[model samples]
Target: MKKFICIISAAVACIACESRTYEEISDNTPIAQVVTYNKDVKAIIDANCVSCHSPGPQALTNYSQVKGNINSIIDRISRANGDPQKMPQGGSLSPAQINIITKWKTDGLPEN
Candidate 1:
Protein backbone atom coordinates (compact mmCIF):
# COMPACT_ATOMS: atom_id res chain seq x y z
CA MET A 1 0.00 0.00 0.00
CA LYS A 2 2.87 2.42 0.75
CA LYS A 3 4.54 1.49 -2.58
CA PHE A 4 1.32 2.07 -4.43
CA ILE A 5 0.90 5.45 -2.82
CA CYS A 6 4.45 6.45 -3.72
CA ILE A 7 3.97 5.39 -7.34
CA ILE A 8 0.70 7.26 -7.61
CA SER A 9 2.28 10.38 -6.11
CA ALA A 10 5.16 10.19 -8.58
CA ALA A 11 2.79 9.75 -11.46
CA VAL A 12 0.71 12.70 -10.37
CA ALA A 13 3.81 14.89 -9.97
CA CYS A 14 5.02 13.98 -13.45
CA ILE A 15 1.62 14.59 -14.98
CA ALA A 16 1.34 17.97 -13.32
CA CYS A 17 4.73 19.10 -14.63
CA GLU A 18 3.67 19.93 -18.17
CA SER A 19 6.26 21.25 -20.59
CA ARG A 20 5.79 24.53 -22.41
CA THR A 21 5.09 24.64 -26.12
CA TYR A 22 7.39 26.40 -28.59
CA GLU A 23 5.07 29.38 -28.85
CA GLU A 24 4.87 29.75 -25.12
CA ILE A 25 8.61 29.45 -24.76
CA SER A 26 9.17 31.96 -27.51
CA ASP A 27 6.78 34.41 -25.99
CA ASN A 28 8.84 34.54 -22.81
CA THR A 29 12.14 34.86 -24.69
CA PRO A 30 13.32 38.40 -25.30
CA ILE A 31 14.61 39.52 -28.67
CA ALA A 32 17.85 41.48 -28.37
CA GLN A 33 17.52 42.98 -31.82
CA VAL A 34 14.92 43.72 -34.45
CA VAL A 35 13.80 40.96 -36.79
CA THR A 36 13.47 41.71 -40.49
CA TYR A 37 12.54 39.82 -43.61
CA ASN A 38 15.76 40.23 -45.61
CA LYS A 39 18.03 39.49 -42.68
CA ASP A 40 16.02 37.02 -40.70
CA VAL A 41 12.96 35.51 -42.32
CA LYS A 42 14.04 35.18 -45.96
CA ALA A 43 16.68 32.60 -45.17
CA ILE A 44 14.32 30.49 -43.12
CA ILE A 45 11.69 30.59 -45.86
CA ASP A 46 14.21 29.90 -48.59
CA ALA A 47 15.66 26.93 -46.77
CA ASN A 48 12.32 25.51 -45.66
CA CYS A 49 9.44 26.65 -47.84
CA VAL A 50 10.60 28.01 -51.20
CA SER A 51 11.22 24.84 -53.18
CA CYS A 52 7.66 23.62 -52.96
CA HIS A 53 5.78 26.88 -52.64
CA SER A 54 7.56 28.84 -55.37
CA PRO A 55 6.60 29.08 -59.04
CA GLY A 56 3.23 27.65 -58.13
CA PRO A 57 -0.24 28.72 -57.14
CA GLN A 58 0.97 29.93 -53.74
CA ALA A 59 4.42 31.28 -54.28
CA LEU A 60 6.78 32.62 -51.57
CA THR A 61 9.77 33.56 -53.67
CA ASN A 62 9.91 37.20 -52.66
CA TYR A 63 9.11 39.65 -49.91
CA SER A 64 5.79 40.70 -51.36
CA GLN A 65 4.59 37.15 -51.63
CA VAL A 66 5.82 36.26 -48.20
CA LYS A 67 4.33 39.33 -46.58
CA GLY A 68 1.05 38.76 -48.38
CA ASN A 69 0.85 35.21 -47.11
CA ILE A 70 2.07 35.94 -43.59
CA ASN A 71 -1.11 34.73 -41.91
CA SER A 72 -1.11 31.38 -43.70
CA ILE A 73 2.61 31.12 -43.21
CA ILE A 74 2.23 31.52 -39.46
CA ASP A 75 -0.63 29.01 -39.32
CA ARG A 76 1.19 26.35 -41.35
CA ILE A 77 4.46 26.79 -39.53
CA SER A 78 2.74 26.63 -36.17
CA ARG A 79 1.35 23.15 -36.86
CA ALA A 80 2.98 20.18 -35.19
CA ASN A 81 5.55 18.20 -37.15
CA GLY A 82 3.24 15.31 -38.09
CA ASP A 83 0.28 17.52 -38.86
CA PRO A 84 -0.73 17.20 -42.52
CA GLN A 85 -0.98 20.96 -42.98
CA LYS A 86 2.38 21.82 -41.40
CA MET A 87 4.75 23.66 -43.65
CA PRO A 88 8.21 22.36 -44.60
CA GLN A 89 6.44 19.00 -45.10
CA GLY A 90 8.84 16.33 -43.81
CA GLY A 91 10.47 18.29 -41.00
CA SER A 92 9.97 21.01 -38.42
CA LEU A 93 11.70 24.32 -37.91
CA SER A 94 13.57 25.02 -34.70
CA PRO A 95 11.98 27.21 -32.06
CA ALA A 96 14.56 29.92 -32.79
CA GLN A 97 13.73 29.92 -36.47
CA ILE A 98 10.01 30.04 -35.86
CA ASN A 99 10.51 32.75 -33.26
CA ILE A 100 12.44 34.84 -35.76
CA ILE A 101 9.57 34.78 -38.23
CA THR A 102 7.05 35.48 -35.54
CA LYS A 103 9.16 38.38 -34.39
CA TRP A 104 9.40 39.67 -37.94
CA LYS A 105 5.64 39.88 -38.13
CA THR A 106 5.40 41.48 -34.72
CA ASP A 107 7.99 43.98 -35.92
CA GLY A 108 5.66 45.02 -38.73
CA LEU A 109 7.11 42.92 -41.53
CA PRO A 110 10.19 44.93 -42.22
CA GLU A 111 11.98 44.08 -45.47
CA ASN A 112 15.36 45.21 -44.32
Candidate 2:
Protein backbone atom coordinates (compact mmCIF):
# COMPACT_ATOMS: atom_id res chain seq x y z
CA MET A 1 0.00 0.00 0.00
CA LYS A 2 2.78 2.41 0.82
CA LYS A 3 4.54 1.67 -2.48
CA PHE A 4 1.32 2.19 -4.38
CA ILE A 5 0.75 5.49 -2.60
CA CYS A 6 4.29 6.58 -3.43
CA ILE A 7 3.81 5.66 -7.10
CA ILE A 8 0.54 7.58 -7.26
CA SER A 9 2.16 10.56 -5.55
CA ALA A 10 5.03 10.46 -8.03
CA ALA A 11 2.66 10.30 -10.92
CA VAL A 12 0.75 13.27 -9.60
CA ALA A 13 3.97 15.16 -9.11
CA CYS A 14 5.10 14.44 -12.66
CA ILE A 15 1.79 15.57 -14.04
CA ALA A 16 1.88 18.72 -11.99
CA CYS A 17 5.41 19.46 -13.16
CA GLU A 18 4.48 19.12 -16.80
CA SER A 19 3.99 22.48 -18.46
CA ARG A 20 2.01 23.19 -21.58
CA THR A 21 3.67 25.25 -24.29
CA TYR A 22 1.97 28.32 -25.75
CA GLU A 23 1.32 26.51 -28.99
CA GLU A 24 0.01 23.54 -27.09
CA ILE A 25 -2.24 25.78 -25.02
CA SER A 26 -3.54 27.58 -28.10
CA ASP A 27 -3.61 24.72 -30.57
CA ASN A 28 -6.76 22.78 -31.55
CA THR A 29 -8.90 25.25 -29.64
CA PRO A 30 -12.07 26.56 -31.31
CA ILE A 31 -11.34 30.06 -32.47
CA ALA A 32 -12.72 32.41 -35.09
CA GLN A 33 -11.59 31.33 -38.55
CA VAL A 34 -10.99 34.11 -41.08
CA VAL A 35 -10.20 32.54 -44.43
CA THR A 36 -11.02 35.83 -46.15
CA TYR A 37 -13.17 38.26 -44.33
CA ASN A 38 -15.31 35.75 -42.50
CA LYS A 39 -17.38 36.41 -39.38
CA ASP A 40 -14.63 35.47 -36.94
CA VAL A 41 -12.02 37.79 -38.36
CA LYS A 42 -14.69 40.36 -39.06
CA ALA A 43 -15.79 40.35 -35.45
CA ILE A 44 -12.22 40.67 -34.23
CA ILE A 45 -11.45 43.42 -36.71
CA ASP A 46 -14.74 45.15 -36.11
CA ALA A 47 -14.03 45.28 -32.44
CA ASN A 48 -10.32 45.98 -32.81
CA CYS A 49 -9.08 46.93 -36.27
CA VAL A 50 -11.76 48.95 -38.07
CA SER A 51 -11.48 51.96 -35.80
CA CYS A 52 -8.15 52.86 -37.38
CA HIS A 53 -8.17 51.07 -40.73
CA SER A 54 -11.60 51.93 -42.05
CA PRO A 55 -12.13 53.76 -45.37
CA GLY A 56 -13.95 56.87 -46.59
CA PRO A 57 -11.55 58.64 -49.00
CA GLN A 58 -9.79 59.58 -45.78
CA ALA A 59 -10.90 56.43 -43.97
CA LEU A 60 -11.01 52.70 -44.69
CA THR A 61 -14.09 51.18 -43.12
CA ASN A 62 -15.40 47.59 -43.33
CA TYR A 63 -13.74 44.28 -44.17
CA SER A 64 -13.97 44.71 -47.93
CA GLN A 65 -11.69 47.72 -47.86
CA VAL A 66 -9.19 46.00 -45.65
CA LYS A 67 -9.35 42.60 -47.26
CA GLY A 68 -7.57 43.92 -50.31
CA ASN A 69 -4.64 44.91 -48.13
CA ILE A 70 -3.82 41.48 -46.77
CA ASN A 71 -0.08 41.98 -46.67
CA SER A 72 -0.41 45.23 -44.81
CA ILE A 73 -2.76 43.62 -42.33
CA ILE A 74 -0.40 40.75 -41.70
CA ASP A 75 2.51 43.11 -41.28
CA ARG A 76 0.53 45.26 -38.92
CA ILE A 77 -0.43 42.26 -36.85
CA SER A 78 3.14 41.02 -36.81
CA ARG A 79 4.45 44.36 -35.66
CA ALA A 80 1.46 45.20 -33.52
CA ASN A 81 2.19 42.69 -30.80
CA GLY A 82 4.87 44.94 -29.28
CA ASP A 83 4.38 48.22 -31.13
CA PRO A 84 2.12 51.24 -30.92
CA GLN A 85 0.56 50.68 -34.36
CA LYS A 86 -0.96 47.53 -32.93
CA MET A 87 -4.63 46.86 -33.52
CA PRO A 88 -7.18 47.97 -30.94
CA GLN A 89 -4.44 50.41 -29.86
CA GLY A 90 -4.27 49.31 -26.23
CA GLY A 91 -6.14 46.04 -25.98
CA SER A 92 -4.44 42.74 -26.80
CA LEU A 93 -5.73 40.08 -29.17
CA SER A 94 -5.76 36.47 -28.17
CA PRO A 95 -2.97 34.25 -29.47
CA ALA A 96 -5.62 32.15 -31.18
CA GLN A 97 -6.93 35.14 -33.12
CA ILE A 98 -3.45 36.20 -34.08
CA ASN A 99 -2.62 32.69 -35.15
CA ILE A 100 -5.75 32.56 -37.29
CA ILE A 101 -4.85 35.76 -39.02
CA THR A 102 -1.29 34.67 -39.57
CA LYS A 103 -2.44 31.34 -40.93
CA TRP A 104 -4.93 33.03 -43.22
CA LYS A 105 -2.24 35.23 -44.66
CA THR A 106 0.10 32.29 -45.02
CA ASP A 107 -2.65 30.32 -46.77
CA GLY A 108 -2.81 33.05 -49.46
CA LEU A 109 -5.48 35.09 -47.80
CA PRO A 110 -8.27 33.01 -49.28
CA GLU A 111 -11.76 34.49 -49.50
CA ASN A 112 -13.61 31.51 -48.14
Using lDDT as the measure, the top candidate is: 1
Residues 16-62, candidate 2, lDDT per residue (tens digit)?
99888655776556445445656446676777776766555424365
> What overall lDDT, based on C-alpha atoms, would model 1 receive against the true structure?
0.89
Candidate 2: minimum summed lDDT over ten consecutive residues — where? 55-64
Q: After superposition, how far is residue 55 of candidate 2 from its true place, in Å?
A: 3.8
Note the Cα lDDT for every prediction shown: 0.89, 0.66
Please provide TM-scores, in order, for all candidate models, with all chains considered together: 0.73, 0.56
Give the C-alpha miss distance for residue 89 in model 2, angstroms.
0.9
